[model samples]
Target: MLPVGHFAGPMFIAPDAVEPESYEVRYEDGVFSLSAAEYAVWALAHGDPDRVGSHRPTRQALTAEAEATGVTEPAVTIDALISDGLLALIEDEPAARRAFAERHQLMPLALGLGNQPSQLGVFQIGMPNTPRVSVGYDIYHMWLFCHRERTLWAAVQEIAGEAQEANDAAPAGDVELIADVDDLLAGLIEALPILLSTSCGFLDPRRPSPTSAPADDAAGSGDDGRGEDPAEDHEHGGDALVAQP
Candidate 1:
């Protein structure tokens, strides 16, 4: 349990779906779906409690949320979000800084500064029920040159490019193939940020979840041959890159 005495403390939210009505948080390889009110309570950690319009972790804030959402018990909702790992108590600003720092490695990769997979670079991330990305090579596995090591952005661009190329080879006005191309393109674009973050250890390693199992059975499962091929659905099956949301 996090001690809430420190007003300056902030916590980390997992790589989650921050939707208006609900939140899907992936932590320790498990997916937690939070109610709107609960999500509101958890969102308090994103900023200062004393800030205007930002959420504050307190009974008064809970009352207002309860009145707005009709949850009837905001305290219970808050407790549930806290315990479920969708929201965490960051302890202090220093800890908060470290948590945020860990996520910084993602920006560079997301902005198209990455390398190709000369050797297979497999990155399996996201919780089981949330967004999961599995990247691998079908064949031609060799040592990847440091200048061309696989990066999330590069992989997405590569697979998506191949898919586009396939669609181009298809006859003109081929609506089905074109639509499939669009889905692959859109999926890859959506997957870029999340995959990059996952590669950079998007989840705070310090915050352990009770529902989580050994990492060998969790996110690590992404690299295993037993898992489904991420790029199997793509028409151009030359590359193995898949992202699911």
Candidate 2:
């Protein structure tokens, strides 16, 4: 069992907390966007949601793992994981363990199907009584963890190897095509959210009406006592302005 107060950490992050960094993976015209940290968290949560219930390790254990993995700071890593929606804090150890296992099993399968490499690799850390998912790597330096089982890392490495093999089997022609298509697709992807937002009325740049206006007054309307229409001010005349003598 985890220590007495290990589960007492904050359940939810504050709104002002740092946002996860996002990455876009483009294939042809379709683009999938996710944060690096989120990808890590997803691997964890998808594999096992129950893992969050385990007793957290001492600061020393975390520090040792971080140093070995080049993480330098455990808090930053934890924050990034939480921000990515991969992991969560829960009060129940059994539930957390189950969740963590589920996440571990699912993540490799998902990545394998998508034909992408699994960057994060699982590792165990800390004392035997209260072992935890220590920071570790796979092909890349991405961190991974599985709190429920000590053998999870070994399984993850095997799965990662399979994923790498699948990714490697693509034809050279297909690779070039994907590369060319992704380059063209990038500009469209970056512009898409802005385009959609503008298309929707919700993101209009117009200002809100003052509180002095009637409750029914729409946003951006003028406040003249004479009830001059604000919409009329937006009308454009074809002729340029000219000075009169």
Candidate 3:
């Protein structure tokens, strides 16, 4: 008998989404859209495929769970997701644990902050015991956590490797290291879309909250103190002024 599996890795969830009536999942070139009813079953059983055997729920049980979440789908999305490799069923508990740990062998060598570039963090979504995240900042550092960290880094390395021939023309010494660093940054930039979808950008404790509402003074900039609409007053059109840097 084929055992059930959950999502192969973590994916983002909307903070406002409790039990989505419909869900659309996109991975690389693969896009799987789910209706709200179908998605209820999926959401109920998703996350932690490796441990599914320990607490297997019957399709009937899943249907009830879905209905409780306000969904009435008959649980068709489960089979579809398992077939896509988006969810992989691992029957061995110990083996799955080993697989998860051995998957990523690299760690951050150092940590610092700036407007510069590095691998962004990967986030796990809907995982058991893990808090749901919705931070949307594109942090320059690898501060998020995702199941695909090593896979992404490996791809980045291959891309950056293509630039080695150009670096060979320069004098050796530290040039190789510098070039590699440049390549790594370039790779991160290239992988921006992947990171954005798969992970949550982390917020720095030092930085002010980006989501804070604008103050009264800043919000009404260019408007009269009486709260006139600046744009409305300029119906005659305004001149385009270029400012010096």
Q: Put down candidate 2 lDDT per residue, 89-198, tens digits, no spaces.
A: 43334444333323321111012111114533433332344432332223111121222122223333444454456557866654221222222223222221222221
Model 2 alpha-carbon miss at residue 21, Å: 10
Poorly placed runs, candidate 2 (over 4 Å): 1-63, 88-92, 98-245
What digit string (tens of lDDT, one per residue) describes model 3 on residues 96-214?
42332232211221122222144233333323454233222222223332222433344334434544655676576633422353345333333322222232221000111235432
Give me the displacement of residue 110 in model 2, in angstroms: 9.6
Model 3: how far is 21 from its true place, Å?
A: 12
Best by lDDT: 1
Candidate 3 stretches greater than 4 Å from native: 1-22, 46-64, 70-75, 90-92, 98-149, 152-245
Deviating ranges (above 4 Å) for candidate 1: 1-23, 43-69, 91-203, 207-245
Q: After superposition, how far is residue 10 of candidate 1 from its true place, in Å?
A: 26
Candidate 3, 97: how far from true, in Å? 3.9
Task: For each candidate, give its TM-score against the true structure.
Answer: 0.29, 0.20, 0.29
